[model samples]
Target: MARLALSAIVMMMAFIAFTEGLRGVGPKKCCFKFNDKPVLENKVVSYSRTSQRCSNPAILLNTVAGRQMCVRPSASWVKDLVTYLETKNVAGANSNL
Candidate 1:
């Protein structure tokens, strides 16, 4: 009886570990439309894998764009991201198509 209980406990532990730890359900990345074209400039990043948080450069950095739109993500955003290299779209849609 004791051996059977021990076996059951071990089995339960294995089940829990497999379900929670060994799973590989990471964030998925996909393309998004920007400036009338698909912008794939940023690499697919996960909240857990990113070394640093998502941050915008200082207002000084955007001095060239006329206005500064500096906003940083406070918390980790777990989701998909389109890599710049993989995403590409033409400027004019009617002519290109």
Candidate 2:
């Protein structure tokens, strides 16, 4: 349970880093790295909380935890990103999700 909760937090932070870009400082050219052999099987990329930050959307969709996290973006920042992304796709950026 603790692991899951921690994972969730990590995922959310990662989402914010990419989707919102760290306090409007702008995107940081990020990417998600994972080891899926246990469940994702796509561990080519490498990124841990301690690793450098990134802002690439491809990173989020490439893994299980990442995919879930990408579904969420900071509420305050989504409007701008969505506008930039040019889509009304706030399907997962909500707190309810």
Candidate 3:
């Protein structure tokens, strides 16, 4: 019985450590407001309405030196910007045809 108890304790400790390690491994949660620093329109690479893996919707943008930036989706300006980009992309594709 004492050996069994020791084995159980070890398993529980291992489970806790595993869970803690996982908690630190995923993407960092982020929230943004409209009044924050303006993201350049020309720098936007693409946008995703809702990232299934992310906690909230975000706009993907290319920042200085090719880094990516995730911006909040709730902003009206962000919506307009996405629409504009989509239309621009379509138009560009058509012109190439």
Which is the leading candidate under TM-score? 3
Q: Candidate 1, residues 1-97: lDDT per residue as tens digits?
A: 9999999999999999889875555423222211222212233221122222213211111223343222122321211121221233233444577
Best by lDDT: 3
At residue 68, give the lDDT of candidate 2. 27
lDDT tens string, model 2, 24-85?
76453444543222223342122222213454333232343444223223333433433433
Candidate 1 — what's its lDDT? 0.33
Lowest-sum lDDT 10-residue window in model 2: 43-52
Candidate 1 residue-wise lDDT at 35: 22
Winner on lDDT between 1 and 2 is 2
lDDT to native, each model: 0.33, 0.41, 0.69
- In the range 2-82, model 3's lDDT, one tens digit per residue, is 999999999999999999999977666443532346666776766554345666656665544676666666677777777
Give TM-scores for every candidate, taking all chains together and pairing residue i with residue i: 0.28, 0.22, 0.53
lDDT of 3 at 24: 74
What lDDT score is found at residue 37 in candidate 1?
23
